[model samples]
Each structure stands twice: as C-alpha cells, then as structure tokens.
Target: MAFTLNVNGTDMEVDAAPETPLLWALRDHLRLTGTKFGCGIAQCGACTVDIDGVATRSCQFPVEAAEGVKITTIEGLGAEGEHVLQKVWTEMNVPQCGYCQSGMVMAAAALLKDIPEPSDADIDLYVDNICRCGTYPRVRQAIHRAAELLKA
Candidate 1:
C-alpha cells in the first residue's frame, strides 16, 4: 500500500497499510521522527501532528485517513527550528526531560494560532498534553512568551 501524502509542503510516498497508524508511517516510512509515540492510544500527546492546521494525535490516526491532508510534524514546525513557539520554548526552558515538548509545542502553536492572547484559563483548557516532569508552569509561560513574540 503506497500512499502519497502531502507533508510539510512536500508530496512523499509511504508504503504502509491503510489501518497502520499514521505515527508509524511518519516515523518509519517518512523518517520524520520528531513526533514521538508515548502511548499507542491517544491518551498521551507525544504523537501529535498538525493535520490541516489542527493538532491531531498520530498514534491512532490511520495512514489512509491522513492521505492528501497537510501534515506538519515537529520537524515541520519551522525551517531549521525557527518557529516562534520553538524559540519561546527554548528561551523559557519549557521542558525538563523534553519528552513531551514536541507535542506541547504543537498544541500550544494550534492554540495560539486560534487565540493570540489566550488567557490563563484558555491555556489550561487548550494545552492538555501530560508531562510527568511537571513542566506545566514553564509550558504556560512559554505559550505566553510566544504570544508576546507574535504580537511584536
């Protein structure tokens, strides 16, 4: 099964089953390993990727379902890691272990794109990726800082 996918502005071919999780196709077939697989179920956000501008869990999403959609993994966030959110994440030192940072950044990016100056409540509601490292405070701060950077 060869599926031609539009990922990060490029059309690439992936040989995988229709029901194969999009995470495996991205990581194994496409070699885009930035999207991590924390849990096979969608409980953890480590496998998040942007599907048509929405943060989608790649772990459960099927390859066929993602066909023809614009898929953006952490590697696609910006060219050479220059996205505003990435910059803010670095400056704020948002990650402790850095395991969940990719998903955190993707979720935050989606949230900020929708709501530029998100309130703390909005942050609490939108950014739901779990981090055992307890980096929630820094994640929130980084989102705020990214918002500020966007405004400038």
Candidate 2:
C-alpha cells in the first residue's frame, strides 16, 4: 500500500504494508533513524514521536494510520538544535545510555507544550516512560529547566 505521511511539516509518500509499524516506516522507509526502537511493543517509549503534536508510540502505531497526520520526530523538534528541551537535556545531562533520550525529550516537549510549569507529581504521572539508567530525577530536572527556559 502507498500512503502519504505528513511528517515534520513535510509530506512523504511511502510504499509499505498497511500494518507496518510507523517506527519501521519512519526508520526503514523514510530513513528517519532518530526515533529509536528499544522495544517493539508500546511498553518502551524509545520510539515515541509526535502525531499532530501528540506524543505517540510509533512502534505500536501502524503506518497507514499515520496518513495525513503531522508526525514530528526528534529531528524536527529543534531548528538548528535550539529547542528548549534539547538545551535543557544537554544542561542537565539527562541521558545515561542515550537510547531513550529522544523519546523522553519528545514526551517532555509535549508535556511542556501543554503545561509550561509542570510539577514533580505531574511529571511522575504523565512522564511514565521508563529509563533503565535511573535518570528519572535528571529527567525531571531537565523538564523543569526546559520550562524555565521556555518562560525566559
């Protein structure tokens, strides 16, 4: 099947099976490797991306389902690598293995987009994406830092 995906403010036509996971389509078909694949299932947020500005697990999402939706991966989040979240992540040194950072950043970006100043409890509740490196505290710190940067 062929479908046109609106990703990162660009339209890309892909030829793939309807049931192909968006992760594969993005990485294999579209050659967007920034979205990592930690777990093929949705349990891991490594493959997270923004579908119409909503953080979504691309691994579980079918490529055909992404048609016409605006998908934003880590590559699209910043212009010239200046996104507040990216800057905060660098400042906070949030990643340990660096595998989950893309998804973590995407989730944090979405959270900050809605709640400019999210509390610790809010982050705990919403940012359920796991990081095996035990970087939760650093992640929280980065989120707060990004929020502050966004405010300034």
Best model per TM-score: 1
Question: What TM-score, over all chains together, does every model reach?
Answer: 0.97, 0.96
Ten residues in sequence with the least summed lDDT for candidate 2: 79-88
- Candidate 1 stretches with Cα past 4 Å from truth are none
Q: How do the residues 1-152 of candidate 2 rate in per-residue lDDT, one tens digit apiece? A: 89999988999999999999999999999998989998888988999998887889999999989997899999999845689888878877888998999999899888988899999998986677879998999999999988887898
lDDT at residue 8 of model 2 (Cα atoms): 87
* Model 1, TM vs. native: 0.97
lDDT of 2: 0.89
Error of 1 at 114 (Å): 0.6
Task: In model 1, state the lDDT of residue 20.
Answer: 97
Off by over 4 Å in 2: none
lDDT of 1 at 151: 97
Candidate number of the best lDDT: 1
**Candidate 2: clashing pairs of residues:** none
